[model samples]
Target: MPTHTDQVPETPRRRPPLGPEHRWVILGVGVAAQASFSAMFSGIPVTAITMRADYGLSTGELGLVLGCTALGVAASDIVWGLLTDRFGDRRILLTGLISTGALLVLMSLAVVPTGDGRPPMPLLAAGLLLAGVLGGSVNGSSGRAVMTWFREGQRGLAMSIRQTAIPVGGAVGVALLPWLAASHGFRPVYAVLAAFCLVTAVATWKWLHEPDDAPQGGGGTAGEPVRERSPLRSREVWRLALASALLSVPQMAVLTFAAIFLHDAEHAGAVAGPLVVLVGQLGGGAARVWSGRYTDRHGNRRGYFRTVGALSGVVIACAAGLTLAGAPVLLTASALAAGGVLANAWHGVAYTEIATMAGARRAGAALGLEGTTLFTVGFVVPLAIPVLLEQSSWSVVWAVAALAPLLGVPLAPGRRP
Candidate 1:
């Protein structure tokens, strides 16, 4: 037996049988995990109306539901990362899927606004917070598995495809859950998502493998795995954080309220609400894969990040403008453009860069930190935007979102020290 101190081969030491690649199988499991986790988040937009109708919740209260989830996502990332780093990815991933699935079912079946005719705000808030925390697991443990399995140049494409699971799950939620809730009520939505999550959790546990090549020594790979110390420990981390923060605000803002903004501010009709979200998600899913491939080929992410950041800002501004213009034809296109470019595109590269920057050994922590920052924005933006909109018009609300990408401009290639 090889000593724990011995180095593993860089490539798969014992290759799988030809004509049926195991890598694709692993990717499938990862995608399924992400899809299941996404179902947990996807319910927000799809079920918001139902929640409001049932509870007679105000905008601030509704925003709190979304914010609490983001708070859960932000707060739990480090814990998930540490767990993935300590336990094997397969175990953590399975655990996340199971716990999240159980919670999703609980959420679907939970009866809020109980007793004496008052809504159960605290109970509902608690559930949403719990769901968000569980949802964060999707990106951490499974993401670590994907990063560990894929080679450097291939990470972008692999991660992007994995990222696609989000939209695929979201699209499913958008198309099915809302309709189910509208017709059969929320129980069906919970039952369907829970069943899907459990099935995927079982499949992931049974089939997912840490790549044979995962950098290992006897004790297991833990902490920063990069050859050099993390650029994150230096000023670069702050720079990256700033860029990530700026872009995150707009990204989350739109996600939290795109449908609401369209329906209430622009009068786009109720049917268009979830459809717009689906379009953005689908566009983002495709862009994530494309951007990953692009980053893999380029070898450096600076230009790609800078370009996407700028373009996202531009797209957001255009969308906001078109939205305010009240022109039906242009509004949908611009909205989709923002969703495609800003919402999902930048993340594929950003996360890929985080994985690569940390190297295989430390990728988990890097991703953990990255997710923490991103979801923190997720927590803040939902609550913040509603407050912003409270005193002002939707245009002011969106303009604030549009400025997010600009904050990243200082982090572009030449600007960073």
Candidate 2:
């Protein structure tokens, strides 16, 4: 269950998370809050042109700078998860969002290059890493909020909606931040990203609250009839977490390489590459919501994940084969789009299943563990892709990537009731 603070006297405790009466409002707040952070996490990469220019970073250095955020996220998720368990989701959300915004403001004032002098590469990289560490709170906190506030039938839908906020915020960031960076400067880009966090923080403060049934002092199992399953020790939890991480590998493969591969192979980076990205992100967002709602009614999240994993493997393998055979670019793009959507489609479903297995009380740690594993892979995939490409052909690299999702299919446990 979600909780706001310890020793709540009267005032803040009255507000809801806000229970069934205003749960949708809580969801809206969650989406907006998540989107704000997602924009920074996903959008910053798109500002590479201006960032590289201002910082005078080499291509390799730029990769490290970018990788730093993912590293921080991987490093801190479990810590945040543990904190979320001790505190509550709202407290963590408010603290994390506000601190994130504050750090960005600091970056605008101190870190970004000004008047022809550049900040140290280490400083810039460290700032991004710290931002990731602060912002990473959203994953477990927001998810735990859903697990507490919503019951099973709607939890899948709710979780997926929350999940889509990442891409929605990201798409907005990608669309806007690059232009802002080019036109105004990094100060304004930092300011705008900070604005997203601050604005969402306000929403979170006003709307996010403890559910009516939450434990008074804290959330985890204080008043329960039985002690909840601790996800940290559960074999099922580890298996599902591992499965989720494995499937994400193929999604990362498509996300990181589709554009570069298309550019090199078909010189279609101008149109087809972006088209594939747009298709994957947008379509993946829709597919996630749709699948979540579908499975909510069907009661088969594990089964759903298994099917999607197999299909993701098949579709991506086809895309790789088409590229290798020098087939029509349209067919390859279509295949990539399908593969990306399928690969991403199961995130909410898998997270819901994992959280469900762990129970609401332990949801934070379970989700945190899952995010840590996925992000660790996320950090590794981008770096590994280039190395694998240099050592082997594109066909070999993509063929290897396709196997990841297939390998993940068996890792999900049987459907939970």
Scored by CA lDDT, what does every candidate get?
0.72, 0.81
Clashing pairs in 2: none
| Candidate RMSDs in order | 6.3, 5.7
Q: Residues 137-250, candidate 2, lDDT per residue (tens digit)?
A: 988998888777787789999999988887677768767776788788888888898999999999989888767767765564334433455689999889999888889887
- Badly placed stretches (over 4 Å) of model 1 are 1-20, 112-119, 213-234, 329-333, 336-340, 412-417
| TM-score for all models, in order of appearance | 0.87, 0.89
Give candidate 2 misplaced runs (Cα > 4 Å). 1-19, 48-54, 113-115, 182-185, 220-226, 269-274
- Estimate the lDDT of model 1: 0.72
Q: Which pairs clash (backbone N, Cα, C closer than 3 Å) in model 1? A: 113-119, 113-120, 225-361, 225-362
